[model samples]
Target: MQLSIYSDKNYLPKGMEPVPMLYPFWTEFIPSEKYPWSRLYGKYLEISNSLFKMTSLQEADLVVMPINWRVIRGESWRSKINKEVESLSIEFAEKVANSGKELIIFFAGDCCVEEIPVKNATVFRMAVYRSKRKQNDIIMPSFTEDFVKEYLGGQMSLRHKSEKPVVGFCGLAVKDSWEKKLKTVLFHGAMLTKSLELGVSPYKGQILRSQALEVLAESPSLVNTNFIIKDKTVFLNTQDVEQRQKARAEYVKNIVESDYILSCRGSANYSIRLYEILSCGRIPIFIDTDCVLPDESIIDWKKYCVWIDEKEIPHIAEKVAEFHDNISDQEFLDLQHECRKLWKSRLSAEGFYTNFHHHFSRK
Candidate 1:
C-alpha cells in the first residue's frame, strides 16, 4: 500500500531536512574514505523511491512534525525545548488537529521529553518501556548501519556450532568515577519519587550491565566470553577522532567474531548494539527489561535472539549454552542469515520507513 506524508515546512528546524529521521532517503552524503564509523551512518540500504510519496496536506495520509523531538538541546535530566520551536510545534499541531489528521512525530535519541504536548499524534521513540507504552506510543527500533553488507561487503561472518557459544560485549558496563556513581544514585532516587507507572529501576543501566557481564564471565564452563568492558561510556563521548575510530572498529570486531553478542540496554531503554548484532548476522542474547521492540507483533523476535528476562540474568550463561546445544550447526548458520535479512528488510533506516506505513494503517 502507498502512504503519502505531509509536514508544515515552517515547523521544520532550520538547516534540517523535512524528515530528519529518514535522512538517507532524501539527502546526499559524500562517502567517508577514512574512518569506519564515519562511513557507518549513511546509505546502508537502497529502497524503491516510490514507497512513500510527499504530497499536499489535503492529499496526505499522515501529518509529520518536521521538528525532530529528539534533537532539541537539553541538559541531563533537565533538558528544555527551544521556546520558538515549542510555539511552532504547538501551532503546527493545532493546525493538524483542526484538519482532523494524525501527526507522526519522530523522537530518536536515548532520552525523550517526558511527554509530547500534542494529543492527536503518534510518537515513535527508541527508548520506551513496554509496560508504560501508550496506544499512540510506538516502540521504534534504533536505526543502525548494516555491518555485514556495509563493512564486510555483504560477506557474513557465520559461525559453526561448537561445544560452547562465544558470547561477546564491548561497551560501558560500570560507572567510571565516584561522581558518576553519585549521579546514578541521585537519578535513581529521583525516579523513585515519580509515579510507579514509569517503570523506574533502582539499578542504572551500567550497574545492570556490569552484573550481567560478571555473571557470564564467572561461568567460564558454560560459555566462552570475549568481553572488552570499560568503566566510561567512551564510544559516543570520546572527542579524539583516532580513539573513536579504534573503538568503533573494536566494537564491530567483537560482534563479528562472536556467535552470541550480549545485548542489553545502555542509557536508553533499548540497545543499539542489539540492532548491530543483527546487522552482522549474529544471534543476540537479548536481556529484556520490560522492553518493547519495533514491529514485535509481526516479527517473532524470540526466533532471532536467545531471549532472556531481567530476572533470568543470573542464569545467562546456562541459557546461552542450552540455546547453543539445541540448534544444529546448519540451523545456527540459517539463524544468522535470517537475522541479517530481518535487519535489511525491517530494521535498517531505509528498510524501517519502507514498511513502517503499515504500522499506522493497522492502528
Candidate 2:
C-alpha cells in the first residue's frame, strides 16, 4: 500500500538531515554500536522504506505521523514537544480523514494515551507502561527491542536435548526493602483497582525475581547462578564492564543449553528474555505480568510457551514438570523448532510489519 509520512520540520533532531519521519523517533534512545542487534534500527529503516512505498499525501492508502515523546532536555521541553505532537496529530488526522485515507500516530515513548488524539486515527505505542483508565480508539502496543534478528550471529545453532529437563534463569534479583515494598503495594494496588473495574483479576505482582528463584531452588533438574539481592536496586550490573559481559555470556550460555528458561518481568511489565528464549528455540516458562504483547490479536502465545500466572508462582515447578512429562521426545524437538519459527515469522520486527501491513490492509 502507498503510505505518506507527515512531520513538521522543527520536530526532528537538531543536527540530523531530513529523513523518514519514523526513523529518528523509533531509534531515539537506542545506543550506538552497543549490541550486535543495534544495527536493527537501520534494518527497520530499510523495511519501512520498502514496505511503506512512500508516496504523495494526496495519493496514499495510509499516512504515518510520528509523535516526539523523548525528553532530550527536561520536563518543560518534553511538555513543549508533547504539545507540538498533539497539534500535529490533530491536523494530520483531519487531513488524512478528509483525503479518505487511514492515519496512524506512532508514539515513540512510554504509554501516554492523553497525547493521542481522540479522532479518526489508530495510535501505535512503544510501551504499555501504564494502566489505561478507559479504552481509546485502536491503540496498538509495539516494543522497540523485542525482536531477535542476529544477536548471537553464528552461535545460533540448535541445542541438543538433555536427558533431564533443565530450567534456567539469570538476572538481577533486587533485595526487599521499605522502598520496594511501597512500590510493589502501590503498583499492584493500582492494577487491582483496574482489575476490579474490568471485573477480571490480572494477578500481577512485583516479586517475580524472588518467586522465580524459589521455584528454581525447588526444581531438581535446574542450573542457575547465585543471585545475591543487593541493598540497592540494580537493573544490570554496570559497575564493572568486564564482569557484566562475563555475566551476560554465562546467561546466554545457560539459556541456550537449557531446555527451558524462566521469563519473568523486570522493571517493565514485559520481559525481553521471552523473545530471546524463543529466538534460541527453547521453551519459556513465562511469568505473566498482565502484559499486552504486540499482535496479540493475531499471535496465540500460549501454544508455543509455557504460561504461568503470577499467583501460580508456588506451583511453577509442578506446572513445568507436568508440561515436560506430557510431551514426547519428538514432540519436544518439534516444539523447539516451532518456537524458532514463531520468532522468525511473527515476533521479529520485519515479520511484525509484514504481517501488520497484510492484516490491516485486508481489514
Candidate 3:
C-alpha cells in the first residue's frame, strides 16, 4: 500500500525555499552532515520510493504543507510564533479542510510540542510529551548513521553479561559555568511545575543524566562505569575541526566499549543517543521521562533497551544489573545483533519510511 503524497510550495513560510516534500527525501542529506560524522547515508536515498510517491493534490492520499514549521519559528527571532502560525498556517489548513484531504506536516527541534491547529493531520516531530501528544502526533526518531557499519566495517562484537554491567556515557552532563547551572536549575523548576499540571514526572534531561552517572558511579558492585563526562557541550557544528573530530572519536569509542549506554533526553524530551546506541548494536539504559517514542504501536522498545522511569533513577544501577543477569551469554550476543537489525529496519531514515506508510494507510 503505497501512500500517495501531495505538497504545495506556496504554503511554505516566507524566506524558506522549497525542499523535498517528504522529510526522508531531503533530511537524510544536509550540508556538513555529522550524525555519524560521514555522508554514507546517501545509499538509502533509493528506498523512499518503495512506500510513498508524489502525486497531484486532487489524487493525493495525504496533503503536505511543505514547510518545516520549526525552521519558520526559529528564523523569526522576535516575531511571536502564534502570530506567525495564525497568519501563515491557517490559510493552508483552510484550503485543505474543504478538500477533505488529511494533512501531513513535519517539525524538527527539541521540545517542539506546539499545537499545529490543523485538523485531520498527522504530525511528525522530534520531541513530543506523551501526555500532550494528540492522536495524530507521531514521534519520530532522530536521524542517525549506522555507526557500526560506517566505522567498524559492519562488524559488531557482543558484550556478554559479566558479574557487573558496564554502563557508559560520553556527552554533556555537568554544567560548565554558574550561568549554565542556574539556567539548568530554572529549566528543571519549570519542568517540575509543568509536571504537576500534566500529571507526569518532572525529571529534566541534564539533571537526570548527572544523577544517573552518580548513581552508577557509587554502586561499583552493581555496575562498572566507563564515562567521559563533559562539562561543556561539544561535537556539534564547531569551528575547531580537530576538537570536533576528537570528540566524535571519543563518543563512538565510549559506546563501543560499554555493554549499556546511558541514553537520556538532552535539551529535548527524546534522545538521539538511543538511536545511535541501537545503530552500534548496543543496549541503551534509557531514562524515560514522559517521552513518546516512534512506532510504539508496533515496536516493543523495552525489549531492545533497559528502560528506567524517572522515579527509578536511584535504582538505575540495580536495574541494569538485573537486566544483564537475566539474559544468558547467547541471548546477550543475539540482543546486540537484534538491536542493530531493529535500527536498520525501523529507526533509520530508510527503515522508517519503508515501514511508515502503513501507519497512515490504516487511517
- Tell me each candidate's TM-score: 0.89, 0.72, 0.86
Best by TM-score: 1
For model 2, residues 112-163, the per-residue Cα lDDT tens digits are 3334434666655533533552332333323234323334664455655555
RMSD for each of the candidates: 3.4, 5.8, 4.1
Tens digits of per-residue lDDT for model 3, 1-363: 578888765666555544333545445334354444234345455666666778887898887877767665542122235456456766887788888898877777654665655677778888788877788888877878778766778788667667778899999885245665666566556545544222222235777899889999999988999999877678885779899888888999999999999999976688999999999999999999888888888889999989999899999999999999899899999999999999888888777777767777656
Query: To one decimal, what is the Cα RMSD in angstroms of model 2 from the true structure?
Result: 5.8
Cα lDDT, model 2, residue 183 = 58
Instruction: Report the lDDT tens digits of candidate 1 across residue range 1-363.
Output: 567777766676666555444443444432335344334444433443456667788988888888667655332443445667777778898998888877888877756525767786898887677766788888777777668766687788878888889999998887346776677677665545642124343236677788889999999989999999987768789899899878888999998888999988876678888889998999999999888898989999999999999999889888999999999989998999899999888887767777877787787
Best candidate according to lDDT:
1
The regions of model 1 sitting more than 4 angstroms off are: 16-18, 21-48, 73-78, 175-181, 188-203
Tell me how candidate 3 scores on lDDT: 0.76
Better of 1 and 3 by TM-score: 1
What number of backbone clashes does candidate 1 have, counting pairs of residues 3 or more apart or in separate chains? 1
Give the Cα lDDT of each candidate: 0.76, 0.57, 0.76
